[model samples]
Target: MKERRHFIRIVYQAPAQLSQSGAQWSATLKDISLHGILLSCPDGWQPGDDPEFQVDIVLPETDVHLTMTAELVAYDPQSLRMKIVNIDIDSISHLRRLIELNIGDDALLHRELEHLADLAEDE
Candidate 1:
């Protein structure tokens, strides 16, 4: 198998809510990266159903918040899985800090950001 992920994923079980086309579901955040998320949406999802989706990264305490809209890249029927597409960076600084906190390092995050920047330039 080939590795195809841009950012490193870290296990994070934060609570979240997903909504699309008048369909809303509470989901358990499984793992996350600066770009995307893998979550368990008990309400289930269908493949190729790219509805207008929003993910609110709800966490305990504090007033900080991070929410983004993403396309549904894939869904697993057997496990009620949901994968969020790469977030368009409207909050890159906050996202960077979140990734740094979870990964527990700044250098790695910086490298990932640089790589992402280079990729953007090439496109």
Candidate 2:
């Protein structure tokens, strides 16, 4: 398939937690973008006919965290692709700053933010 991704993905590894239906698992944060996240699937993950999940990613040694409600868009034996559906204000701010620091291009980051805003407006 043609690459249809509009957001720039940042490869950032961190510790994360995923929970649903009272089951929680520890996962490794693989990569992140404004629209989604990719995580190394936790062991014993039994998707169990449900694709919705809540995630909490903590920056290794700091208080910063990114939390969101996500839908399991796809998954493989090694990883899970989740589309972020909702995020709190604080998490979004932290996420934007993290992306800004890693993205390294001011104009490109601005354009991506604008694109994200346009998407939000359409929703």
Candidate 3:
């Protein structure tokens, strides 16, 4: 199989809530990258079910909250994974900084961001 992701993932044991309308569940973060997040929920979910995620990250210096809507990518009996298809500018900026700091690789982060910017400019 070919590697298809643009960002590196790392174990991020954060608390997040997934919700759609009246349906909701709290889950532990399994792994995260700049583009997607993998979580272990109590139950399975379906693809095409647009859901909103709110992840709370508290640090000693400051606290950050990310609220974004994502599209379901894969799901199993106990795990739910989604691609961050859409996010607000503020949240995306925060996420980018978070990943850069956690990954400890500013150079790599800059390259990726430049690539994304070039693609967007081409569009």
Predicted candidate 1 versus true structure: per-residue lDDT over 17-102, tens digit per residue: 77777777777778777667777855655543454478877655745556877666656742333344445454555667778888
Residue 73 local lDDT, model 2: 94
Q: What digit string (tens of lDDT, one per residue) describes model 2 on residues 23-117?
A: 99999999999999999989999776788899999998899989999999998889999999999999999999999999889899999999999
Q: How does model 3 score by TM-score?
A: 0.77
TM-score of each: 0.78, 0.96, 0.77
Candidate number that wins on lDDT, 2 or 3: 2
Query: What are the root-mean-square deviations of the candidates from the true structure over C-alphas?
Result: 2.8, 0.9, 3.1
TM-score of 1: 0.78
Clashing pairs in 1: none
After TM-score superposition, what is the CA distance of residue 97 in candidate 1 from its true location, in Å? 1.3
lDDT of 3 by residue, 1-123 (tens): 999877688777777777776667677778877778887864554443445544433323456777777656777877777777667787788878777888888899888788767756876
Q: Each candidate: how many clashes?
A: 0, 0, 0
Give lDDT: candidate 2, residue 120.
91
Instruction: In model 1, state the lDDT of residue 121.
Output: 82
